[model samples]
Target: MKALVIDDSRVMRKIVGGILVDAGFEVVEAENGQDALDRMAEHDDIGLCCIDWNMPIMTGFEFVVEVRKHAEWRDVTLMMVTTEGEQDQIVRALAAGAHEYVIKPFTPEVILDKLQFLGLVEIEETV
Candidate 1:
């Protein structure tokens, strides 16, 4: 699977990318929502996008709204991985068309489970 992980923290991005890679996925990085959108626009092979709530250039909510407006990218599974634990923020993200939500301090197991549940990661046979 191919995933685009959008976050402001370099550490967070690397951590998430490592998790995805371990799960047998090719991951791409974006510093912010705008960068994510630009990457998405250029790569149609992207099957999933993991976004962060707060960003400098463009917020994740704004990016979600923008992506939701386009028909082509509607089928992409959008998941938010951030510290925005407020109920209203979760509601807004869901309303804007996010498929899954994962709060910060998440374990790699949590991320893997969500990806599997969302049909983003294909389970491979062990040797």
Candidate 2:
């Protein structure tokens, strides 16, 4: 499946994208929420989005709200991957339509685990 990695930091985008790529997803990138929206519009097959909370042009919360307003995006899973670890912010994102949340400085394992929980990925049993 395709995944969109959205963050203001180029390095963060690369890190998230690399993780998704390793997990067998075709990854697309966006520098911020507006760019993400544009990319999503262009790619109808995107199944997942990893969004950062704060961004220029549009914030991740705004992005989630905008996406949830459209029935076409209903099947797309939204995951917030950001430095905002406060409980209220987490609650807000979930209420706004994020399916999962991951704080920054997370390992690839954490991301993969969340994706698996969301059913966006199948976990391979390790020997």
Candidate 3:
């Protein structure tokens, strides 16, 4: 699967993209919501998106809302990977169409676990 990682911070985008790349996904990076939308247009095979809430051009929440408006993008799973850890913020993001929420400072394992839960990725059984 291909995953788009959207964040204004270059370090954050690289961090999230690296995590997805490690999880067997082709990764793409976008600086903000508008950039993410542009990336989506450029890549039709994007199956997942990792979004950061606060950005310059467009917010991740706004992106989620905008994506939800497009029926064609329904198959794409949206996950908010941001530092907005407030309970209300999580609820709002979910209400806006985010499939999963991951507060920033998260470990790779946490991301993998969320992806597994969303059925976007599978885990192997240990003998």
Q: For this target, which candidate reaches the highest TM-score against the unseen true structure?
A: 2
lDDT of 3 by residue, 1-127 (tens): 8999999999998888888888899999999999999899899999999999999989999999998998889999999998899999999999889999999799988899899889888875546
Which residue pairs collide, candidate 2?
none
- List, in order, the clash count of every candidate structure: 0, 0, 0
In angstroms, how far off is 12's CA in candidate 2? 0.4
Pairs with steric clashes in candidate 3: none
Q: lDDT tens string, model 2, 54-102? A: 9999999999999999999999999999999999999999999999999
Q: What's the lDDT for all of these models?
A: 0.91, 0.94, 0.92
> What C-alpha lDDT does candidate 2 achieve relative to the native structure?
0.94
Candidates sorted on TM-score, descending:
2, 3, 1
For candidate 3, the per-residue lDDT at 77 reads: 98
Model 2, residue 19: displacement in angstroms?
0.4
- Using all chains and alpha carbons, the TM-scores for the candidates as numbered come to 0.93, 0.97, 0.96
